[model samples]
Target: MRKLALNDEILLKIEKPARYIGNEVNSVMKDKNEVDIRFAMCFPDVYEIGMSNLGMAILYDMFNKREDVWCERLFSPWTDLDKIMREKKIPLFALESQEPVRDFDFLGITLGYEMCYTNVLQLLDLSQIPFLAKERGEEFPLVIGGGACAYNPEPLAEFFDLFYIGEGETAYDALFDAYIANKKAGGTKKDFLLKAAQIPGIYVPAFYDVTYQEDGTIASFTPNQPEAPSKVEKQLVMDMDRDYNFLEAPVVPFIKATQDRVTLEIQRGCIRGCRFCQAGMIYRPTRERDIEDLKEAARIMLKNTGHEEISLSSLSSSDYSELKELVNFLIDEFRDKAVNISLPSLRIDAFALDVMSKVQDVKKSSLTFAPEAGSQRLRNVINKGLTEEDILHGAGQAFEGGWNRVKLYFMLGLPTETEEDMKGIAHLAEKIAERYYEIPKDKRNGKVQINVSTSFFVPKPFTPFQWAPMFREEEFIEKAKIVKNEIRSQLNQRSIRYSWHEPDVTVLEGFLARGDRRSSKVILKAYEKGALYDAWSESFRYDIWKEAFAETGVDMEFYTLRERDTDEILPWDFIDAGVSKEFLIREWKQAKAETVTPNCRQRCSGCGAKRYGGGVCHEGQN
Candidate 1:
């Protein structure tokens, strides 16, 4: 029996106390004395949200599979427990061993979203570790970060010792071997980091020097250490069908996670090159798992976790070649058990409508479409492949198939957006409602329910929009009003429901996303002044961040509202994310010209992902 880090008194006082308890089903446990390395995998958010991340789950299973490495898990304690623990002076501990995280050899954090920046500081603070990497010595755990946000690690560079530049499966084994060798040789921590920096896709921020221009733009970013590479390439798994690449068993949470289901990742990377999308540009040359492998994974995962619902995880599910076969296998294999299948991010064509009819309850589920922008011209500028004809055709097919509920997603404040574009969103929603009414009275399910949602655009690194300027919060709110008023004047005003995302949160995200190394102080100052859980709406404090920025002398407008020149030295130039800067520049020019580029399937744009020698780039080739 293992003693929990939290006592019964503390457990009883906190909400969802099960979050701190370990020994959940499928969770790996190992003897500490037998293992040479102890790694604490963290997902920075609350337990429920953190457990739902498939990347963390996959990496956790991968690390624990090694006999010499005993990997555990940790999450940012909720505000209730966060205060209690601080009062009691209880160090943050890993769930598996109930040991203080400060004792671990490695603490790897997943940086999936920019909003979780403040939560990282909370974790380090609770663990009793120094906030700044340079302030820590060998006695502390080597803190590292990875995920989509790692592409722009400079904003948080001073805090993290190193960052894994890409997919966890590609380079972790080599990194671990290097660490073990260094330990056996009795090498210092700096010596081990020097060795780690030499490995592909490993970046030691402390080893590099970033010099800023007088105007605060990064003048030059070069490595000071001989071991650190001048350009760190993004790593990805070329063959996703390898048995070790996909997670075999996910740890069942004691409490229901946000994603409470069996998640089967069908593929990695996206073929559609949307100019505003970061994932599409960063994860280049999409690779998919075999259908047979997927079927086996679904079976084993469902059986192991006993989850009633299984979701197909992918950027775009419709693009997977074997989707029909896999979906059919899932339906037939588990028909007796009556398992629920979730297929998100699918094009609502005739074939997809047919699949959804079989897998989902039309009455309870709503068909979703992300047109992204309103008018065709705006869509072309953003390189969104979906057109008005496609949207209406899909919606009409869904209505005819006995579906009355529809969700349409759009982005406001996009580059080149005008009043006409803003009003076009309402016009599109009304057009979809008109399609639903086209059905005969008896044939229709009931009154149509159209839910229109719009999120303010935030420019992300490595995308064509990286050079774009974001609108102010007031301007964003005014744009939201334009759509709201347009919807009110529509013919089907009663049937449509409209909601816009809070612009304040979006502005902060933009600041974090585009900021350089100097922005780290703002995050630290914000966290020091009770800025934990900025990701959660209830706990977010825009005022706190505003004050932090003012105090730290970080002009948020410089990072968010300034449109950069094509030749400007962006903070993330040091890392190569497969897509060449030349290709991105070309796409930026194409966007300004309102030209459309074909996806990976239709035509090759020569985006430099071909260097990996795999994925759609080599499909149908020798």
Candidate 2:
């Protein structure tokens, strides 16, 4: 029998009681005396969103496989329970044992998004742990961070004890062994951090020193201690199939998750090098799994989880070498079982129609495509290899294949964007609508529905756009207005519907994304002023962040509006993401010239990922 941290009366008061209780399908339970170490794996958001992350699921399964380590799950408690926990003086607890999280050996938080910085603070506050890393003694759990956000760990450096700079699978075993050995030898926390800092991909921020110039630009970043390395090389898993185990039985949430399906990660990275995309740059030289392995994994996962829908996950699903074969196998194997198959991030031009037609969707789903930018010139600037011909031809094929609804995605406030570029979004949608109308009346399903969505672009670290300038909130709003008004003036205006995200939120995200150590003061101040769930639009208060910036006297515009000089020292310069800074600078210059670089398959632009000696870089070699 299990004793819940929350009693029945408290459970009855919360909106979702299942979120607080631990028991769910396939959740690991271990005796405290048996395990040598306890790890609290957390995603600092609500349960549903955290459960949807495939990366977290894989790492959770991997950690639990070790007999000496028992990993449990934790999420940011919702607002209703958050207030109750504070008023009742209840400490944050992990779901598995319902024990206080502060008692764990390690608290590993997956830093997925920049907007969740405040939530990270909230997680610490509720855990009854010190907010700053320096303030905590040896009694506290070693707070570590990973994921894409770890690339720019400077913004959250003061809080995290250490950051794992790359893929989770590459270095965790070594880390775990080090932690256990350090404990057996009775090492101090500082002694352990110094030892961990020497590891290939581990970064201990306290062991590094940053000196800023008079203009607020970073002057130098150097190792404070002899044990720390000058640069932390990002760890990457070379062989996708052999390096890690595919998650067979992911914890099934009691409530419906954002992505309520078994995610089959077909590949690890992307071939497309879009300048504005942090993911494409950070995850370099895509590596894919074998089709046979994926098929077997899918079968086992379906049986284990009892999930009806399965999605093929990748940076670009269509770019997988044997996608058609995999899709066909899934269709043939599960056609009678009523299992739904989905392939996201597929290029519309590349045999996408055939794959979509074969996957028998009980309800016809909308065909979605991301052009990234509306105009061809802008696309070349971003190194987006897509063309107008490619989009129209694919949309036409989809129309003939029985999809009446289409969704097109684009970004606003990209570098070198012009008024004509903004209007081109509507023009592109109009062309797609005209293609849909070409179908005969008798053959048509219904009125062609084209939903257009545009999100404000935020310059991210480790991308070609890292040094680029971003637009202000009003500028972003005016750009969206231009696109909206142009759509209204179109010949096919009735067929299209337009939507855009909050510009204020984008400004805050941009600030956090490119910010450095000084930004931590603002994040902490804002959190103290009741800033939680900034990722959720309803809970986001832009004014609180503004006041924090004013009180701290930190320049938000210095991070967002100013176009940085290439020679200036950037905060994340010391991290080697297998991509050379010289190559990124070259790409950035090419973007200014509106020149396009071919994708990885066509040619290698010498981005330095070849040093890893695997993935697409060494595809044909022994």
Models, CA RMSD each: 1.0, 1.2
Stretches of candidate 1 exceeding 4 Å from the true structure: none
Candidate 2 positional error at 494, Å: 1.0
Candidate 2 off by > 4 Å: 620-622
- Give the per-residue lDDT of model 2 (tens digit) for 225-307: 99999999999888877886678889999999999999999988788899998889888878889899999999999999999
Tens digits of lDDT, candidate 1, 1-622? 8999999999999999999998999999999999989999999899999999999999999998899999999999999999999999999999999999999999999999999999999889999999999999999999999999999998899999999998999999999999999999999999999999999999999988888789888889999998899999989999876644667789999999999999999998999999999999898889988888888899899989989999999999999999998888888888889899999989889989989999986465899999999899999999999999999999999888899999999999999999999999999999999999988899899899999999999999999899999989999999999999999999999999999998999999999998899999999999988898888899999999989988998899999999999999998999999999999999999999999999998888989998997789888531
Give the lowest summed-lDDT range of ten residues in model 2: 355-364
Candidate 2 total steric clashes: 0
lDDT of 1: 0.93
TM match of model 2 to true structure: 0.99
Cα deviation of 15 in candidate 1 (Å)? 0.3
Query: What's each prediction's TM-score?
Result: 0.99, 0.99
